[model samples]
Target: MNKLAYALLTCIVILSLSTSCEKDSIRVPVQTIELSASSFTLATDSVRIVVAQLSPNNTTDTNITWTSSNQQVAIVDQSGNVKGISPGTTLISATSPDGKISASCEVDVIKWTLHKGGLGFVEEGINAMALDKEGNIWICGQNVIKLGSQGAWLMNNSNLNPSAITFDNQGFAWIGSGSGLYRYDGSKWEVFTTENSGLKDNSIITLATDNTGRVIASHFNRESLLGTGASEFDGNSWKYYSSANGLVYDNVISMAIDKSGVRWFVTTNGISSFDGEKWKSYGASNVGVAHIGLVHSVAVDSNNNKWFGTNSGLIKFDGTKWESFTNQNSGMIGGSVTAIAFDNNKNLWVATGAGLAHFDGVKWKVFDRYNHPVQDIRTILTTPDGKIYIGTGLGLLIASLRD
Candidate 1:
C-alpha cells in the first residue's frame, strides 16, 4: 500500500508543477513593441492611420493607447489615428497598460498650400484701382471688387463712379464720388466738395500720394481759382497748381510720385514734374517726351526709369534718352496701352485694349486670345504673391506667378 500511494502522489505533484510552469510562461511580459510607421509625414489639417505591433505574435492585450508630445503640432487618438494640426514636428507614442512597454513615432506636419481662385461677379468692366497696406487690392467699375481668401468679393456693385481711390499714410480711404470726394475715416464718411472743402473741382480724375505723405489730386477738366492744375492736400491745408506754379497744362489726367519724392503730372499737353517747391516741364516738344502725345498712364520703375503708357506706344525715359516699344517693334500683341505694373521680378507688365504684354528687359512675352486667357486687358495689378489680376470689360483673370 505504501509503494502505490507514494507513486500516485509523486505523479500528481509532477502534473501540478508542469501546470504551474505553463501558467508562468503564459504570463510573461512583452519584450518590445513597434509602430507600423517609425516616422510619418502629413500635410496640415490632414489625418492618417497608424498601428502598434506587439512582440511574441500574441494578442494578449494587443490594444494600445496613443498620445502626442505636442497636441498643437499633431494629435493621436486611442486607436492610433494621427492628425496633423499645424506645421511642426511632434513625437507620437503608443503605450501599453504598463509604463514599461511603449512605442514611439516621429510625426511631421507640413504647411497647407494656398489655393488660387477666381473673383467673377462683375458683368461690366473694372476701371479703378486701390491697394491697401494689408496687401489687398480693390477694383472699381460698375461694381466695387475686393480680393478675398476664396476669390474676388464684389463689395459694392453700385456705380459710385470711383474714378480714383487711395489710402493715405494715415489709413484714410479717399474715394472719388464724381461730384464730391468722400473720405472714409474708419467708420464715418466725410465729404469734401468744391462748395464745402478746399477742393479745386468736383471731378477728381486721379489721386496720388508722395513719400512725404502729401496727397495730390487732379481734376479731369476743371479750372482752379489759383490757375493751377492739381490740388494738393497736406492733411491740413490745400493748394492748387497751374501756370503760377510753372505748370503749362491744367487738365491733369494722371500723376505719379518717384521714390525720390518727386511728383510728376501727365496732362493732355505733356508732362510736368514738381519736387515740393521746384517745378519742371516736359511738353510734346520736350526731348524726353519727344513730341509724343496721348499718354494715358505713367509709372516709375525701381531704378527710377519713367514709363509712360500712350495711345500710340509705350515710352521709357531714363532721364536722358527716350525708348519706344510699340506693336511694331516689340512682342506686344495689343494696342492702346491702358495700364502698367511691375512684378516682383521687375518684369514690366502692360495692359492694352487688345491684349496683355510683359517685358523682362530683354525679351517680350505677349498674351493674346490665341494662347492667353484675357482679351481686353484694361487694368492689370500684380500681387505680392506673384498673382496677376487682370480686370477686363468681361471679368477678372488671375494668373499665377509660379508659372
Candidate 2:
C-alpha cells in the first residue's frame, strides 16, 4: 500500500508542475507601441534609425512592420529605419504584425538640406542666382537652372551666355547676357538690343531693378567704337549714361538701388551713385578711411546703407560716414569679398574668394572647407524662408538658417 501511494503522489506532483510551466510560457498580446521619436527632419538621401517600444514588455510577438505614407518623400524598411527620398512631409508608422497596436512619427524631408551641392547639375559653378515671386530659385551658369517644388530643371536659354539676372517690380525676369538684354514674363522670352530698344549698346553684362519699376542695364564693350556704358529703361524710354557723362568708370561690375531710389554702381576702380538727375562718384582718395579698391559688388541694405565688396575688404557708407571691415579686424573668412546679401533676420552673408562669412550684427560665423563643404564662394543669396543659396567653384551649396 505504501509503494502504490508514493508512486501516485509523485505522478500528480510532476503533472502539476508541467502544467504550471506550460501556462507560464503562453504568448501575450501587445497592449501598446511607442516610438523613440515623435518628429524629426532628414535631408534627401539621408537615413535615421528609430526604435519602437511595445507595452507588456514580455510579449512574445515583438515583431514590428515599418511603413511610410509617402514612399516618394520617405521610405521605411522592416527594421524601422527611415530614409528620405525627396523634399516633403511623410508619416512613418510602426505597427504590430496584427496591425492592431501602432505608433507613428512625422518626418520632414528636405532636399539639398545639409552641406550638399549641385555638382553634376550646376557644372562650372552657378554664375548668378535669383529668387522669383513664388520663392523659386533661378540660377545661371552655362545654362539656366530652376529649383522649385518640382526639383531642378534646365531652361537652356538658347546659349545666350547670360551673365546676370534680376526681377522687376512686376516679377518679370530681366537677364543681361553677352548678346543683349532678355526679359522673361514667366512664359515667353523677349530680347532687347541697340537696334530693337532704346539701349545704346547690345553688350549687356549687369542688371538691376529699382523700387520705381525701372530696369537698369550695364554694358561692357572693348571695341573703340562700341564703347562701355549703362542704360535705364522705364518701359517706354531709354536713358544712357557712361564715363563720358558722370560715371567714374565705364565697366560696371555690379549694381543695386537703395531704399531712397538712388542707384549705386560698383566698378573695378571705384563706386558711383546716381539719383536720376545727378551722378556722384567716390574713390579711395575722396572717401576717407574707406578701403575702397577693386570693388567687385555693391549692395544696399534695408537701412539704405551702401555696402561695397572689394578685393581687399568690405566698406559701408552711410552717406555722411564710412566704415571698413577686413579679415584683420573682423571674422571675415576671406580677404577678397565677392558678394554680400542680407537674410530675413537682417543677418549679413558675405561670399569671398576663400569662404563664406555670416554676420549677425553682433557676432560672426565663418564657414569654409574645413568646417563646411563649400569654399571659393563666388555668390550668396538668401530667400525669405531662410534658405541660403551659395554659388561656389565646386557647385551650388544650399543651406537653411531657420531655427
Candidate 3:
C-alpha cells in the first residue's frame, strides 16, 4: 500500500513540472511591421518623428533599430526620429532586433521654408526686401517687417507706404516712400522731402546704394505729368540729376551698379549708363527691341552681363550681343518676368507672373502651385548663406540650398 501511494505522488509531481516547463517555453514571434508614413518631405535642420507598428500585440521581441540609408541627407535615431541634413532623398528604416521584420519610409530632404500669409507676415505681398549688416531681413509691403533669429516684428515708420528699401555699408537703412525718403540708423529715423532736402520731388520710387556708400533715390510721381529723375546722398551732401542735367530720362524705374562701378539707370523706355563723367542712352529703336517700356527690373550677373526683366520676356545684353528668352523660345514658365536674381551657385532665379523658374545655365526647373504653394511672385533675393527669399502674393518662400 505505501509503494503504490508513493509512485502515484511521484507521477503527479513529474506531470505538473512538465506542464509548467511547456507553458514557459511558448513564444509569439513578430510576423509583420509597418510604418506610419510611406513618404514625406522635410526641410534642412528639421526633424520628424515616425512610428512603427507590429503585427502581433504581444510580441515577445519588440525591440527595433532605426537607420538611415543615406546619413549625409538624413539621420535616424534609435527612437525613430529623423533629421534632415541636406537636400536629397533618403530611406528611413525600422528593423527588428533580429533583422528579419522591418518597415521603411521614403524621406525627401529639401531646403524649403514656407511662411504663409498670416503666419509671419502681416500682408499678402512684399514689394521690397533688404538685408542688413547683421543678416536680418527687412521687407516692406503694407508694413515694414524685420525678420531675424528672434522672429518677425513690424517697424513703425510714421505709417508710410514704402516703395523701395536699401541698406548701406554703414548699417543704415534707407527707405523710399511715396511722400518722402527716410533714413534709419538702427535707433533714430530722419526723413527728407522737397521742403527740407535738395530732392527735386517728394515722391521716391527706387533706392540703391553705390560702392562708395552713396544712397541713390529715384522719384516717380504718379500725379505729376513726368518724373523728377534721381537724387544722390553722400552721407553729408545731396546731388540731384534730371532730364535737364545729364540723365537720359526723368522717369527712372530701377538702378544697378556693375562690377566696374558703372551706374545703370533704367527708365520706362530707355536704359542710361553713367561712368561718373559721361552718360549714354539705349532706347527701343537703338537696342533693336520692340518696346523697352515693358522693362520692370534689371540685374547684373557675375560676368557683368546685364539682364533685364520685361513684361514680354527676359533680355540679356552681353556687351556686343543681345539675347531674348520668352515662353515661346525657352523653358520659361511665363512671359512676364517680374524679378531676377543670381544665387551663389550662379543659378538664375526668375519670378514671373505665372510661376518661379530656376536656370542652372544648363537646365530649367519651374515651380508653381502644382508642386509648391507659390503664386504671383513679385520679388526675389539671394543671401550669402545660400538662402533664397521669394516674395509672392500668397506669402514669403524661403529656400535653402546645399551645393
Q: Model 2 over residues 88-140: C-alpha lDDT tens digits?
A: 77899998888888999987665553223453264666778899999888887
lDDT of 1 by residue, 88-160 (tens): 6789998876667898988766542322223554355666677777677777676556666666775543456
List model 3 lDDT by residue over 168-236, tens digit each: 878888889988888889998888988998877778888878667888898887786577799988888
What residue pairs are clashing in model 1? 228-241, 228-242, 229-241
Ordered list by TM-score, greatest first: 3, 2, 1
Greater TM-score among 1 and 3 belongs to: 3
Per-candidate local distance difference test: 0.73, 0.81, 0.81
Q: Name the runs in model 2 displaced over 4 angstroms.
A: 1-122, 222-227
Q: Name the runs in model 1 displaced over 4 angstroms.
A: 1-123, 150-159, 221-228, 288-291
Candidate number of the best TM-score? 3
Query: TM-scores, in order shown?
Result: 0.64, 0.69, 0.70
Residue pairs in clash, model 2: none
